[model samples]
Target chain A: MTESGHSSGGGMTARLVAAPRVRRGARQKVGDIVLSVVLIVLSLFMIVPLVWLITTSVTTRAEAFQLPPRWIPTPPTLANYAEINSLIPIGRMALNSLIVSVLATAGALLTSTLAAYAFSRIRFRGGNTLFSVLLAALMVPVQLTVIPLFILMRTLGLVDNLAAVWLPATVNVFGIFFLRQYFASIPRDLDEAARIDGAGHLRILFQIMLPLAMPALSALTIFLFEATWNNYFWPSIFLQSNEQMTLPVGLVQLQGAVGGGPAVVVFAAITAVVLPVLILFLIFQRSFVESIASTGLKA
Target chain B: MSSAPVAVSTVRRRGIEGRSNLAGWFFVSPAVLLFIVFIAGPFVAAMGLSLFSWDLLTPARFVGMENFTRLFGDATVWLSLRNTFVFAFASVVTHIVIGLALAVAVNRPLHKVVQYVTRSAIFFPFLISWAAVSLLWKYVLDPDFGIASYYLGRIGITPPNWLIDPQWALPALIGIDWWHTIGYTFVILLAGLQTVPGIYHEAAKIDGANAWQRFWHVTLPIMAPTLVFAMIITFIGAFQIFEPMRIITDGGPSDSTRSIVLYLYQQAFESFQVGYASTIALVVFAIVMIVTLLQLRLSRRWMGHD
Candidate 1:
């Protein structure tokens, strides 16, 4: 973009252009190469541990324990992966994680979009105050609220239930704030035309607004799903029983019990936990980066 | 009488204005209800609970100012608070410096493939949960037959028991935390960097300014707010550090790595001290707000100078 921009500004005097262009060539070429090298080095630093993780996961337990640690498992086996089931209810836990993530993400999408639409478009009694309160809640860290939530769950006889996990996840104050901003940026004229055609708020949101905000909404969905799936703190603290525990919590237990001795099992558990999100990120790499980038630009 | 009833019904229904107001309420009610039930109501209840002593099994009995007074004298509280500050401080510094460096390096007009690989590599660790990354490092840093020991031994340096030794444990956690989260800060700054107009650098160049001068005078000023935003979020996240200590260290080796949040959890769950935990919760809340406000004030001066 920068280079193209420079070329398009060709209207500048030849001397001005030529001087910098020459300097840019010599200086920038050297600088960029330096930075490129730096980038690769940093990239390698980030990737090596992940490589070690995958390699270690595939190795046999005996090979894993061996000194001058085998980078390549001499006859890589899935025995550890098979043993993971007897070790813990790994499959069931994955299903629990999946179910909770889906439910929470869906609920968040529905509730936040509705609230965002109302906040952005409609002027109602107490609306501003309500929105302000929601924003104010952002200052209160989620960790602080857990004690109260635990009590609340206990009071409601939901001490060990998944409800305690998913209910709070479904409504994020930040999500409402973000989608409101995104929805507001959209030209009101687009929705105004729909209103003129006798369309209702629901129709306007679903048909006109949501389609336009799909990129942002999907980005939000990706974030919420990953967070809920990867969440360990709340689930670990609240859900005591194994059946209700999500993958993150379950994987930790698998380590505590059977993963104590076999390094391979531990690595395999971590890999299994990380793999789904890694694959999703690869598939949606462009938009995920864009959404994150765009978020930063907002502040 | 029939006409009167009809007229009253029409006025009550009141066409677009009334109906639209109802619609607005309907739209926002779910979120509002969630706020009231989960956040607002629980917060108030917890505040009340702080003024009383109660185990989970027993009925509440009021004991005013006891938990509050107990909080200041608690030695573990101070230790945990100090550890939290240290962790948060180290995390913020490392993340901002390294993340910005990575972003600036990537932002230069690199090849498309180079850009993609750098981004994916940086973000990959961040995608994994804290539990996994913490455990992964715990294994990697295992003193016996672990890679850290193996490699460092070759250089004739004995690696300390990374998780067991008090001195090395916190630093080890700090390094792992940096590895896990630097990507988030990088993406944020990269986004901010792109928002910097190319023309500013060009104008600076035309004035015979060097690269450093351009970055300092032009780019830094433009990027200050975004950098502050990144720092604030990173600090908040760091301050709430729990998973790593809970999983790997278990707040061990003379209580070196016990953060405020982890301490609060143990106080509540392990000891069943709900009232005291609520008091600790308030402290956490107060500290976060005060520090965040302080950051905002400092950022004002920071941006003003730039």
Candidate 2:
């Protein structure tokens, strides 16, 4: 984009366009070659640890810490993967993580979008004040509310339950703030037109506003999914039972179970834990990165 | 559809009052109820709990100011407070410097491909779970059969026990903390870097400014708001550090690495000192608030990156 902009501005009018075009082509090729080499080297660094993790996971415990590390395991096996069930309820933990993440993401998106819509379009007494307080709520560290939440859950007899982990996280200030930032940008004319057609507020939000909010909603969903999936602290404290552990907590359990196993096994456990998230990231790298980047700028 | 809300049930004069106020309340009821019960109510309850010293087993008794008074006299709590502050500040400083450096280095227009790779490589660590990173580093830094120690031993240097020794443990934990979250800071900083137009750099170059001069004069000011914003988040996150210490040291080696959060966790969970733990949590909150205000005051003259 930068190079094209420079070329378009500098050489198009004075010199023959063909000569400048050739120079631009040469520069672009040179740039691409350098870029490819650099990217490959960097990409290798990003990928090698992952490759090592996979290799280490499949290798025997005895071969884990050979004086010189083995890049590949001969006769690779799934013994380590199989050990997960015997060691702990690893499959159940994965399911718990999936359930909690999906439910929290859905709940968060619904509540936040409703609140965001109300804040963006509706005018009520103390509405702006409430919104300002919510913004301040974003800056309040999670720890402030965490202790209170624990007590609340304990009092409600909801401790050690998945619902305890999912409820508070569902109504986050950041989600409201994020969706509001986007929703505020949506033109209000369509909303007014819908209202004139006798469409109610809920109808406007669903039929008119939501369709235009696909980009922001998708971004929010991706962000929420990643966050809830990776969330550790609340679940750690809330879910005391092994069966209820999420992937992050389960990985910790796996680490403990190894009880000083070969480095390869530990690496394997970590690999198992990180794999799903990494795959998801690779698939939605653009959305993952853009959601965060756009949100940060929105702040 | 024609019978929607019994539109014709009421007489014309009273029809305006026919709409259910309950419906509007119902629309927002779930969120309002959850927020009050889970957030606002707990926060108020915590404040009240901070004033008492109940262990959840004995009958409730009020002990106003005793818990806070005990906290003042408790050397361990004080030590934990200091350690927590140092850990938080060091990690925040390291993250900002290293993250900003990585962002600026890779933010260059000259090496677009290199920039992409550098950004991706740096961010790769951020995706790794905190426990995994902690375990990986614990092993790597382990004295026996550890890769880091193995390399150091070749030069006839013995590696100190990272999670065991009192003096070295906190620093080791800090180093790992920096590594775990530096990618997050870098990503945020890089996003900020993307917004600064290249035209400013071009104009600076036309003025015959050196690279260092251009960065200090043009880039820094433009990036100030972002730097401040990232710093605030980093400060808060650092102060709340818990997972790694919980996994790696468990606040061991005579409790040198015990952070305020860890102390709170142990107090509440291990000892079941709910009231005392709430008090400690309040102190932690106070510390965070004061430090943030102080930092905001300090950054006012130079920092405007909000």
Among these predictions, the greatest lDDT belongs to 1
How displaced is residue A292 in candidate 2, in Å?
1.9
Model 1: per-residue Cα lDDT at residue B226: 85
Candidate 2 per-residue lDDT over residues A57-138, each given as its tens digit: 8988777655445777897877877666666687798899899999999988888888788777765445667677666555
Runs in model 1 deviating more than 4 A are: A1-24, A257-260, A295-299, B1-16, B293-306
Cα lDDT tens digits for candidate 1, B1-306: 669999877887676567778889999999889888888877787788889897888888899999999999999999999999999999999999888878878888888888999999997787788878877887778887567778789999988988889998999999999999888899998888888999999999879998789888998899888888888889988998999999988887789999999998998999889899889988888887877777668777876751
**Candidate 1, residue A66: lDDT:** 70
User: In model 1 chain A, where is the ten-residue run with the lowest total lDDT?
Assistant: A1-10
lDDT of 1 by residue, A213-236 (tens): 997898788777878988999999
DockQ score for model 2: 0.31
> Could you give candidate 2's per-residue lDDT for residues B206-261 as a string of tens digits?
68787689889998998987888788778888888898888888888898888889
Each model's DockQ? 0.63, 0.31
**TM-score for the B chain of model 1:** 0.90
Off by over 4 Å in 2: A1-51, B1-28, B110-113, B152-158, B291-306
